[model samples]
Target: MIELRGVHKAFGANQVLRGVDLVVPRGESMVVIGGSGTGKSVALKCILGLVHPDAGTILVDGQDVTGTDRESFLARFGMLFQGGALFDSLSVWQNVAFRLQRGAQRRSPVQAREIAVEKLRRVGLKPEVADLYPAELSGGMQKRVGLARAIADDPEIIFFDEPTTGLDPIMAGVINELIREIVVEMGATAMTITHDMTSVRAIADNVAMLHDGVIKWTGPVARMDASGDPYLDQFIHGRAEGPIEAVR
Candidate 1:
C-alpha cells in the first residue's frame, strides 16, 4: 500500500537518510527498529510529508506523493505521535474528532463527539473520559486517546511513532495488543517505529532495522531471533557489546 525507493533526506550539514527503501503491503504491519538518532522518525515524517525528502520517491497506492499536494495525501492516513501530541486545551472528544471538524468531512460538534465516544470505546476507553481534558488523563490514557483519534476517521493507513515509549510494561502491552487488534479489524496497513522488542512481538508481522541511515535487515518477526545478522542480533538481544556502536 506504501512504498519508498531511494529515499534520502538531510538537514543542512547533517545527512540523515541515505538511500532508504521500504514497503508496506496492504493489510500488513511493518515495524521499524533502530537506536536513537538513526533517522527512524525522519523516515516516518517523510512518508507523512511533514518532512520533505531531498531525494527519492514515495508512493501511496501507486500514486507518486513526493512533495505532492499534502492535504489530500494526509487525509488518507492517521498518525499517533510519540507523545500523543494532544492539544492541552481541547477536551478528549474534541481531540479525537479534530478531523471531522475540518474540510468536507465537517460535522456538528455533537455528531463529532458521538463518533469520538464510539472510537474511544473501540479503544477500551469509557464514555466519561470523553468530557475530560488531556491534562486530566494519565500517560496511558492519553496514549489511548491518541489511538482513538487515529482510527476515528477509519483511515486506510496508520503510522505509530514510538507507541510504547513512556508507558509501564503492562500498559505498553495493552497498547500493543490494541494496535494489533485495530489493524486486523480495520484491515488497515500500519507502519510503526519502536525499539521495544515486546512491541515488535505483539504488533509486527515483519520487522526492519534502521542503522547508518538505511535499512540493514528486513524479514518476518519470527526470523528476528535466528536471522544471524550481527546488527539484528545485537538489537534484539539488547547487548552493550555487539556490532552496533554504543552511544557514548
Candidate 2:
C-alpha cells in the first residue's frame, strides 16, 4: 500500500535519510525498528508529507502523494502521535471526535460523540471517561484515548509512533494487544516506528530495521531471529557490542 524509493532528506549539515527504500504491503502491520537518531520518525514524516524529501519518490496505493490534494490525501490516514497530543481544552470524547467534527467528512456533534464513545469502548475505555478531560486520566488512559481518536474515522491506513512509550510493562502490553486487535479487525494497513522490542513482537507482521538512514534488514517477524544481520541482532537483543555504534 505504501512504497518509498531512494528517499533522501537532510537538515542543513545533518543528513537524516540518505536513501530509504521501504514497502508496507496492504493490510499488513510493518514495524520499523531502530536506535535513536536513526531517522525512523523522519522516514514516517516523509511519507505523511510532514517533511519533504530532498529527492526520490513516495507512493501510496501506487500513486504519487507529492502533489495530491492535502485534504483528500490526509482523509485516508489516521495517526497516533508519540505523545498523547490531546487538546488540553477538549474533553475525551471531543478529542476522539476531533476529525469527525471538521472538514469534508464533518458530522453532527451527536453523531461524532456516539462514534467517539464506540471507539473508546473498542480501545477499552468506558463511555463515562469520554466526559472527562485529558488531565483527569492516567498516562495509559490518555494513550487509549489517542488510539480511539486514530480509529475514529475508520481510516484505511494508520501510523503509530512509539505506541508503547511512557507506560508500565503491563499497560504497554495491553496497549500493544489493543493495537494488534484493532488493526486485524479493521484490516487497515499499519506502519509503526518504535524501539520497544515487546511492542514490535506484539504488533508487527513484518519488521524493518533502520540504521544509518537506510534499511539494514526487512523480513517477516518469524524470520527476524534467524536473519543473521548484526544490526538487527544488536537492536533486538539490546547489546552494546555489534555493528551498530552505541554512542550515537
Candidate 3:
C-alpha cells in the first residue's frame, strides 16, 4: 500500500538518508529495526511529509503522496508517537477523540466521546479512565490511551514509533499484543520502528533492518533468523561486535 523509491534526505553537513527504498503491502504489518543513528525515524518522517525528502518518490496505493490532498491524505493515517504525546490539559477521551472533534472529519461532541470510549475499550482501557487527564494515568495507561487515540479514527494506515520505549517488559508485552491484535482486527497497514525484538516478533508480518541510511535486509519475520545478513544478525542478536560499529 506504500512505497518509497530512492528516497534521500540531508541536513546541512549531516547526510541522514543515503537512499531508502521500501514497500509495505496493504493490510500487512512491516516493522523497521535499526540502531540509534541509522535514520529510521527520518525515513518515517519523509513518508509522513513532516520532513521533505531531497529526492525520490513516495507513493500510497500507487498515488504519489506529494500530489495528494493534505487533509484527506492525513485523515487516512494515524500515528502513535514514542512519547505517547497526549495533550496535558485534555481529558483522556478528548485526547483520543481530538481528530474527530475538528476539521473535515469532525463529529458531534457526544459521538466523538462515544467513539473514544469504544476505542479506549479496544485498547484495554476502561470507560472510567475517559474523564481523567494524562497526568493522572500511569505510563502503561498513558500508552494505552495513545494506542486508543491512534486507532480512534479507524485509519487505513498506522505508524508506530518506538511503541515499547518506556514501559516495563510485561507492560511492553501487553502493548505489543494489543498492537498485533489491533492491526489484524482493523486490517490496517502498519509500519513500526522499534529496537525491541519482542515487539518485532509480536507485531510484524515482515521486518526490515535499516543500516547506513538504507535497508540492509528485509523479509518475512519467520525468515529473519536465517537471513545471513551480518547487519541483521547483529541487530537481532544484539551483538556487540559486527559490521555495524557499536561506538556510534
Give the winner by lDDT. Answer: 2
Q: lDDT at 186 for candidate 2?
A: 97
Q: After superposition, how far is residue 105 of candidate 1 from its true place, in Å?
A: 1.6
**Alpha-carbon lDDT, every model:** 0.93, 0.95, 0.95
TM-score ranking from best candidate downward: 2, 3, 1
Point out the higher-scoring one by lDDT: 1 or 2.
2
Clashes of each: 0, 0, 0
Worst 10 residues of 3 by lDDT: 12-21
Instruction: Write model 3 residue lDDT over 1-248, tens digit each, in one string.
Output: 99999999999988889889999999999999999878989999888989999999999999999999988999999999888999999999999999999997799999999999999999998899999999999999999999999999999999999999989999999999999999999999999999999999999999999988789999999999999999999999999999999998
What would the per-residue lDDT of candidate 2 be over residues 68-174, giving only the tens digit for each residue? 99889999999998888999999999999999999988999999999999999999999999999999999999999999999999999999999999999999999
Assess every candidate by TM-score: 0.97, 0.99, 0.98
The predictions' CA RMSDs to the true structure, in order, are 1.0, 0.7, 0.8
State residue 122's C-alpha deviation in candidate 1, in Å: 1.1
